[model samples]
Target: MVPKAFEAGYPKTLGFRKVVKATIYVKKKEGMSDEDFIDYYNTKHAQRAAPILQRHGIISYSLTYHLERDRKMIQDIMHGKAQLMDYDAICTFVFPDYLALAKFLYDKDGAALSSDHDNFMDDKLMKMMVGDEYLLIEDGNKVG
Candidate 1:
């Protein structure tokens, strides 16, 4: 079942654990300041979400904010090399599998975690991509 140009026993045999990763592209609430958005998401939302996610065996989770000034400088130096994205931040949540992800998202008694989204995130602009992590490199070494 090898794809074109791929060697036999490639990805799965590379010794890396396969995990489901959700990449959430988030936008700040309309008229919300960047500082406030970052602060609330880190100190408020993430704090509240961690316990629920951990209970469901979430492997890892992180948030990365946009660096507009740095990106602009890099783009200027390289003559607009970096494409700009309108997202305020990118959130990554890694789970052991789909079942864990489902539970984390739905098994809760109340929508405490998701309801918190309104505090800082723009619902209309948020997007999520869920898929298996295809690790090609780790610790500067090739794994696949």
Candidate 2:
């Protein structure tokens, strides 16, 4: 669910507001040596990462793996109204302002997160980060 404030503020901030989404894809190394990557992401990493991001003013986000239905949905969105073409894991952020988002992405914590992921990720894994503008289809979508 989206927060009341975000619902009220989104439209007003539409032109001024900025939303960022990043996708990270993981692949294991040969001989199953990199299986730990999956375990880390599915268990500890996400939980650990969430609080850190929250501290940086990330209003909402989620981590997801690719599924058949997800592929279909992405195809539909790309071919349909929204022309987004690429992404795997989508992390959405609604900051108080654009600068906050920029700062958070460039800050020490953000850098550490990036580095940590890179350090653990196998060379075979294809990781990428892409940014995009988002429309809030619903309010407080991230808050539980």
On lDDT, the leading prediction is 1
Give candidate 1 misplaced runs (Cα > 4 Å): 1-16
TM-score of each model, in listed order: 0.81, 0.48
* Backbone-clash count (model 2): 6
Candidate 2 lDDT, 32-139, residue by residue in tens: 332454566657656666766777677676655543456678779778565443333333445554555566777786667765565444544566554544554448
lDDT of 1: 0.78
Which ten-residue region of model 2 has the weakest summed lDDT?
A: 1-10
Q: By summed lDDT, which 10 consecutive residues of candidate 1 come out lowest? A: 1-10
Error of 2 at 67 (Å): 5.7
lDDT of 2: 0.53
Q: Identify the runs in model 2 with alpha carbons over 4 angstroms from their true place.
A: 1-38, 67-88, 119-144
Residue-pair clashes per candidate:
0, 6
The TM-score, computed over Cα atoms with residue i paired to residue i, of candidate 2 is: 0.48
